[model samples]
Target: MNNNNFLKPLLFVGPHIILFIVFILIPSVYGIYASFTNWNLIGDPVWVGLDNYKTILTDTDSTFYSQFFNGLKNTLLFVVFSVPLLIIIPLLIAVALEHKDLKFTSLFQTLLYIPGLISISAAALVWSLIFNKQLGVANNLFGSEAVWQTTQPYAWIIILIITIWAGIGGNMIIYRAGINGVSKDLYESAEIDGAGPVRKFFSITLPSIRFPLIYTMVMTTAGAFNVFAQPLMMTDGGPRQSTTVLMMYIRDLAFSHGESIAGLASAMAVLLGLVILVISAFQYYVMNRNAA
Candidate 1:
């Protein structure tokens, strides 16, 4: 390759590089620096060094601890319920579509993917109406009067339903791509060996798509941690703050509260980042160990 080939690629990518540096890297570094100080919007940051962290962990009256714990709990619960369904349901649909005998596979794939393309805010708004006690079709169909958000477990159920509805389609497409990439020769070989569809899936199809499965799992975990828009739009952190997530809490701290502890919000963001990093690392280790 000539020297100009390298220069041309750099020219194409240079704008993105500059934008990333300006928008992401600079802000991230500044946020980290701000985390160790006491700064609101107007005043000069006073170096408080660990005081914000101390307040988050120890201040009972502040409700910071409660919010953090509640958010953590809800996020974990959402992950636990949604992740498996996200994987399994999509995988099953992909497998069904992979069959040559299936009719209108292209049409089915398009219909399934339509939901993923819809704006999350729009989807959440529609579901919010669906879960509304007085006007919702769900209440009307069931002849029930329970307030979905005010009720304990039902509130969570509503959140889960909306989450699954919006999320499953993207994963399904990924899985379908993975399934399509598997060579027909492998299936023929399995057939010659008297292996059934179930056997072929477990032994051949699943192993062929291990990388996609791992990628999806990691993305899902990170997405769960950063879940803000759905709960924020659908529940507003809730009738009892049942749907409040960590990101929403951080936003509330940084902007909504007049005290506006930019430092505390930064700390929370950093801590959440650390949690995601640790979980991802652990997952990678376990996967590699199992492969080995």
Candidate 2:
């Protein structure tokens, strides 16, 4: 190949490579290094080797140990509650919208997808008003006397509501695109075989969109594990820190009052990343194996 041929491809992808290195790669490398050190975000990171990891992983009597485990437990709870709904609900909506009888399909799709574009912080403000104890629509419409944010299951309920509302749109759009791309010939053949809607869905539609299904599953699960803003903005990790996810603890440690404990924070972040990586890998493997 001529030099021009080689350089042209580079020209197309050079900016993206540069951006990834500067924004993602370098920072990730530095963060991992920071996790092994004693740093307060200043005075240079002191090389503490595995001290941070040891404290976080085995020092049960340490406050960081309790915070890490508690935050992790709550984070896992949020993931368990949210990921499945994010996948299944969107898939169902996408499949439902594919019906020939459905009118104004684009309008409905746009309405659903729009919420995903709204920032979580802004969306939380609107939801907060709706779930407000006294003046909110939820209480007035139902005529019930219950505090939504300061209660046990209620606090988690509001968080999940906003999360599902804001999240459903993106995954729905992905599923719709995946469904649309599947060949109509397959569906027609399934119909000729006397397959009903439910049967066609399980036998043909799902199999055809397996790639998108797996892609969304892994991505959604990873995102759910990193969940921070929804619980933070919605419930402020309240009702006694029951809603506090790992990210909240990590953030507080990195930017705490008096002195920052960024080394420990970085260690926590690294652990969270490892959890996400391992789970995402497992999801991909299982889905791919089943698909095969």
Candidate 3:
């Protein structure tokens, strides 16, 4: 191998490696270290060992424990409620657009893809107003006076709506790309054998895009676990904190009024990361096994 060839590859990757270490590796190490201490982000961080984790995981009488679990439960609820719709809706839209006879396919795809480009805060602001109790379009259109944000099911509904609206585009595009990559010969063979649309999709499109399916599933699940802006901006973790996802709890702990609980907050974030990691690994393993 030529010295020049090796140096060229390193030169191209040097910036990315530096960025990852500076922005990701160092911060992750510090965050993990901070989780072991009782830091308030001001005074010296005192070494508290596993005290923060103990309180969060086992101290039922402690407020931190309750908040952690509640937030986690809500976060899981959001994942369960939104991930399927996120995956399925986009896949269906992609498949629909792939049909040769679909009119103005580009236009429809463009319309769907645009939402994912909007900032979460901006999208939440629009959704919040739409679902507002008074002077909101939804209430006027439905002729109902229900407060969407501060209500039980309605609170969750609005958050999920915005999430789906913003999320559908990206996964749909991915699915469309995957679907298009499926060999035309396979579909042709299936059609000659009298395989209908559903059969073709299942036996051909899905299997051909197995890796993409796994990738989207893991990515979508991970993103769902980190949900913050949707519930925060839309419901403000309201309706009796029903919408208070785990990220909200973590954010509140580290930055809310009074002295910050950076230590505990860091621990919670670490725990959330562990959950996502484990779940994503399991998803990959299961999908890879099935593909085999």
Candidate 4:
């Protein structure tokens, strides 16, 4: 019976195992292998051993490496600006909405979450129109002739604005869900102790959602690293490549500029993956240690 019980679980899990092996595991191993070869998608893959990696890491004049570094720098900048809005602003909104005396709570929740439902490509295109140099609504509204996408600081600023606008809603919903999961009795007890909203939030609300906070931080970090579509569509990594993000760099290396360096791109991918993994692991370790 015990053996049959185990077999039953395996039977249910067998399809998932097969799918994972066929899709994720196989592709990952193949990608690593392909990274070491000089495959241009048209000719046979020449086994170059570590040459591709060496070129990517050491070739200072190579556009691939230069673009990769530029993208990495921009991605770091995006994370620095985006993380606080993703975490703190949403938390504040969720806490405010959780108030029993708050008016139109459901309406406010729905309004906040609506932006998250918009398609990223469509949103990027729309923002591009708004940030257009000559005909943009923003230029008209501000009575300034500043070309948002053509100006260095304004290009990055536009990217940041769109990112925050599209992202905050989904994060707010997650935070609201976390806040909702907190036991009402805790709030009631706090109220009985004459704790005001600020005191209750600091002592009870924030502490209870520690798991969600960690989750939000990790996800926002990863998302910030992977920001590609907005910059790709809106800025084309322009304004002197100020908006060039890491994933876009990888994409350009792999397919764009009529010079497909698949192997070098794959090397970049592996390095990026390693960087993300290390950072995420460090974050987890720090958060866990603090909790302990």
Candidate 5:
């Protein structure tokens, strides 16, 4: 009977266990192993220990070295630029819509939420046209001469515009859900204590949503690190490759023209994964400690 009980639980979870091993577990292990070797797709992998890492980290004159640093720098730039806006805008909007006097909130929520559901490629295409120098609404309305895609600051702005538009909806929904869970009694009591809206928000609303804030902060930071499509589709990583992120470099190394540099690419990928793990751990530790 004890064995039967254990077997039942295993049976329920067996499919998921098998999938994790086959798809995620095995591939991750292989990719790590591959990072220590010199491999082209058709040739057998030759073990090179830390050579790939050495080249990427220390060989400053090499193309791989330049690409690695440049890619990482751009990825960090995107994360720094996008993550704060992604968190703050949604939070502000969610709080505003939750006000007692606000009406048709569901209608407003649906409108905000719809953009997150749109495909990135399709959204990027629309945005590209909207920023077009010759016929775009933005240019005509503002009487600007600069081509948004090719111009400095303007190029980055357009990318941020689309990213914020598509991303704000999801975080706003999360904030709304968290906001709804806070006790109404707390607000009423604070109101009786002569607390104004701002004081009540700081004392009640923000503290109540601590977990959701931490969760969204971590997830959004991770997502920002993996930003590829927005820059790829909007700027094609141009304006002199200023927007070429780490993923773009990884993709190009592994699958672009000529022989694939699978091993070196794997090394860069592993390094990126480590950077993310460390940053995420630090964020969680700091935020979770503060919450406690």
Candidate 6:
């Protein structure tokens, strides 16, 4: 009986464990190894020790150096702009939908969540037309003559708009679930104590959903760092590559025309991963300490 109980649980989780090890763990280990070597994805990887990292980090006159810094700067800008909106808008929507007087909550949730299910490529195409300079609805409606794709801040604005639109649903669902799990008795007690909506939210709801807040914030920041599609399709990292993100640079280096700079790409990827790890760890520490 004891063996059967153990076997049954393993049966349920074993496949996932195998898949994670095979796909995620093995690839991650190999990628880290590859970052130390020169690889073109076809020939045998030539061990170059820290050459790739040194060039990317210290070779200020190199094109790789310029690309790395610019890409990282743009990526950080995206995270700064998008992460807060992604968290706050979803949380606000989730809170609004939690109102007792709200009708058709399920319908609203479905409508919001459906966008997230759509592919980023398709969403970008749709948004591109909406922001098209000659015949776009944006110009037609607003009576402005700005070319959204080629303009400075307008280029960034559309990327953020699409990102937030597709992203809002998933985090909102998480917040809604977190909000739903809070005990109703707590709200009633707050009401009895003459707590207003904002007060109750800060005191009761926020504290109750602390884990979800931490989760969404961390995940959203990580996702924002890896952003590639919106800028790729919407503006093609245009207006002098002002919107080019780190992932775009990484992809270009790894698989661009002619020789692939796999080693450099892997180094960039590893660096980006370290940045994410440090930030996520800091966020976890701060949020966990506050919760405690």
Per-candidate TM equals 0.91, 0.94, 0.94, 0.91, 0.97, 0.94
Each model's RMSD to truth, in Å?
2.5, 1.9, 2.0, 2.3, 1.2, 2.2
What is the Å distance of residue 266 in model 3 from its true position? 0.6
Task: Give me the runs in candidate 3 sitting further than 4 Å from their true place.
Answer: 1-12
lDDT of 3 by residue, 185-257 (tens): 9989989999999999898988999988999999999999999999989988998888999999898889999
TM-score of 3: 0.94
- lDDT (CA) per prediction: 0.84, 0.93, 0.93, 0.83, 0.94, 0.95
Candidate 6 structure, TM-score to reference: 0.94
Residues 1-292, model 6: lDDT tens digits: 5789899989999999999999999999989999999999889889999999999999999999999999999999999999999999999999999998899999999999999999999999999999998888999998989999999899999999999999999899899999999999999999999999999999999999999999999999999999999999999998899999999999999999989999889999999999999999999999999998
Best by lDDT: 6
> Which residue window of length 10 is worst by lDDT in model 3?
126-135
For lDDT, candidate 3 versus 4, the one ahead is 3
Per residue, candidate 5 scores C-alpha lDDT tens digits across 140-174 of 99898889998888888899999999999988989
User: Could you tell me which residue pairs clash in candidate 4?
Assistant: none
Q: Tens digit of lDDT per residue, candidate 1, span 99-211?
A: 87889999998888887888989998888888788899889998878788777777778777887777888889899999999999999989999999999999999889988
What digit string (tens of lDDT, one per residue) describes model 2 on residues 86-200?
A: 9999999999999878999999999999999999999999999999998999999998678999998999999999999999988898889998999999989888989999998
Pairs with steric clashes in candidate 6: none
lDDT value, candidate 3, whole model: 0.93
Of the candidates shown, which would achieve the greatest TM-score relative to the real structure? Answer: 5
Clashing pairs in 5: none
